[model samples]
Target: MNQPHPSEHYPVIIVGGGQAGLSMSYQLQKRDIRHIVFEKNRIGHSWRADRWDSFCLVTPNWQCRLPDFPYQGDDPKGFMLKDEIVEYIEAFARKVDAPIKQGVAVTRVRRGKQDRLEIRTSDGDYTADHVVVATGGYDIPIVPDYAHSLPQRIAQVHSMHYRNPGQLPPGEVLVVGSGQSGVQIMEDLHLAGRKVHLAVGSAPRSPRLYRGRETTEWLYDLGFYDLTVDRHPLGDEARHKTNHYLTGRNGGHEIDLRRFALEGVKLYGSMAGIQGARLEFKPDLRKNLDEADEVYARIRADIDKYIAANRIGAPEEAPFRKVWEPESEPLSVDADEAGITAIVWAIGFRPDYRWIELPVFDGRGHPQFRRGVTDAPGLYFVGLPWLNTWGSGRFLGIAEDTEYLAATIAERSASQRAAA
Candidate 1:
C-alpha cells in the first residue's frame, strides 16, 4: 500500500466486453481461470448505438446462441429487434458475471518486461500474462475521400450515427453504399415517404424467404454456417467479402433493389466523384443490379439442388425473374437540383488497430493470425469476421471460437506452471 503496488495484473485480459469477450470470460470461469474484461463503453454499446432504431438480427433467432445461454424466446424463428438484442447481450453479461471494467478505454497495448503485456487504459495501467483482443472488426467508420469535397450545406453522417429517417434533414436523401446498412437505411427513409436517391454499391443480395423457409435456415441445413474460412473457395479473402443484404424487419423480407426501384426509389450506380454541386456516378447501375440478382438466383438454385438431393417435400418455386430495369443510367445528378439535403454513408467500417503496438499486422494493417492465435506469444484476437468460419463473426459461432481460445490459454498456463 505504501508503494502503491506496481500495477494490476491478471492471468488473462480481454480488450472487449462484447459477446466474444463475455463468452471467453464464461469459458475461463468454467476452467477456473482468472481474467478481466475491459470495455470502452458499457456492454452492448455498439448494438445500442451503431444500429438504427429498426435494426434486428438478420439471422433467425435460433442462431442467437451464446456459450450455453441459447435464445429461449417463444419465437425461435422471429428476429429480435434492437432493444431485444441489447437485452439479450446484457442478460448474458449478467449471467456470466464477467469481471468487467466498463467505461474504461484501452488506449495502448505493448510488450512489457518479462514477457508480460502492458496495457494502458483510461482508468489505470495493468499487465497480464496473456491478452485477447476481442474488439470486433467494425471499429472505424469509412467515408470516402470525396466526402470532404461535399458542400457544407449538405449534412453528412455515417451510417453508424444514423438513428432514423426523422434524424435526417427533410428532403431527398442520398444514401451511398448499398451494403446491409446502406440498403436498409434507404428502405427506412423510403418507407418514411422521404425521397431517396440510392448510390448502389456492389454488395450482393439474399432472399429472406425461399421454399417456405428462411434463407438462413436453408443455408444452415446446407452446412454454410459451418464452412471454415480456410476451406472456403475464397480462402482468407472470404473475410473481406461484403455480407449479402437482407432484413429482419416486420417478420423479415428480402431487400430487392429492383423492387425498390419499381416502388419509386431512384437508384444510381456507385458514386464516382463530386464536382461542385453535382455528384457523378458510374454507368454500372444495371451491372450492379444484375450482379445482385445473380447472387439471389445462385442462392435459390443451391437450395433447390439440396432439396432435390435430399428428396425433401419443399414446395417447388419458379426461377427468379427481373421485376424492373432502369431505362437510362444517369451519370450525374446535381444534389441541389435533386433536393438532397443529407447523405448517409453506409460504406461499412475498417478495423483500427493502431492502439495495438504489436508487429502482428499485415501490409493493409489487418492483424495476421490463424483463427485467433497469432505468432506473438500469449497474444490473441477474437470477434473478427470469418475468424474461423462464416459464423465466427456472428452470434452463431462466437461460443465455439471462444471455447477454442479458452482451451489454448489454459494449456499455455498449465505448461508454464509445469516449467516453473
Candidate 2:
C-alpha cells in the first residue's frame, strides 16, 4: 500500500488510534474507503498508560470484543488483563492493515474553506474531506481544588497515574471516591497488606454481573446496551447521575466497599474538605447510595417489563438485596497517622478540547453533535459519553455509533462528488 504524501488529500482522517478510532478504520477499510488515522501515542494507550499492572476490564472478555473481531479465548467470562487488551488491539490493527501515523499528536482540527477539513499534527498537516474524532472521554483526570492544600509529606495521585499498591507508602490508604475505580483500588490496597479507608461518594448500585450470564450479555439481548444518545432520552439522565448498570454474574465475587469492609476496609462518608494535615468527611454517602439503589430498582423493573412485553427471552433474574448503606457521621483523620501516605483521586475525567479550534463545543466543553454529525459539515465526533444512547460511548458499544457516522460521511462524500 502506498503512503500518501503530506500534501496529498485523503477521503477521511481519523483522530485517536484507540478502540473507537481503530473500529472506525476497520469499517472504512471494508468499504474500500481511503482513510488515515492520527494517534498521539501507540495504540491502546489507555490499557498501557492508565491501567494498573493487575487491572482487568470489569466487563468480561466476551463482551469486550470489537466489531469484526471476537475475543478468542477459553475464558469468555474471564477478565482481560491490561497487557492482554493491548496485544489484542495490536493484532486487530495488523489484521485490518489500518493506515496509522503513530507518534503523531493531533494539535488541532479546524474547518478549512470549501468544506475541506484540516488536521494539524506535530509531524505535518493533513487534509481530508471528513474528520472523525474518536478520542475517548477519559483523557483528562479531574482533580478537585482541595488537593493543593495538602501538606508536602502526603502523596497525591489520580486514577490515571495509579499503577499498583507498591507505589504508595506503608500506611492506611484513603481512597477518595466510591466509583468502580475507587472500589477496585481499595480492594487492591487492602489485599496488599495496607490498611484501606474508602471515602464514599454518590454512586449508582451496579452489580458485577446479571442473571446467569454477564450483565453485558443481558443488556445486549434486551437492547439496553445498544442505545445511543440520539435515540434515548434516558441516556442523558444516566450520564448526569453516577448510577451505572450493574449485573449479578460474578458468582460469589463481590468487590464493593462493603465486601472490602468485611475484609477490614474502613468506609467513610464523602470527603468534605481538607484541613491542616487532616481530612474531614460527611457521613451521608450511605443515604445517597441507598437512594440511588431505589432509583436503579425502578429502572430495572421498567426494563424487565419492556423485555417481557416485547417477547424477549427473560434474562436470569438476580435478586437485589440492600447490603451496606452509609452512616451519618462526620469523619476526620490525620494525614500522617492514617497511614494514608498517598491519596488516589479516582473521581472521574472530563474531555479537553483546547486544541480543537472548532465551534461545535457547548458551554460544558462537549462537542455539539446530532448523532455524531457536527454543525460544521464533514466534521464528526464518536466515542463520547451519551453521544446518542446509554451505550454509545462504551468500549463494546461503539460499533453502532461508528457505523452511523461512517455512513453519514460516505453519503456526504458521494453528494459532494456528484456536485463537483
lDDT of 2 at 384: 77
> CA RMSD for every model?
1.7, 3.8
Task: Tell me how many clashing residue pairs each candidate has.
Answer: 0, 15
Off by over 4 Å in 2: 1-7, 209-211, 230-237, 240-252, 295-320, 324-327
Off by over 4 Å in 1: 1-5
Tens-place lDDT digits, model 2, residues 316-359:
57667666644445578887876668888988888888877878
Estimate the lDDT of model 1: 0.92
Give candidate 2's TM-score.
0.89
Q: Which candidate achieves the best lDDT against the true structure?
A: 1
TM-score of each: 0.97, 0.89
Residue 139 of model 1 has an lDDT of 88
- Give me the candidate number with maximum TM-score: 1
For the record, the alpha-carbon RMSD of candidate 2 to the native fold, in angstroms, is 3.8
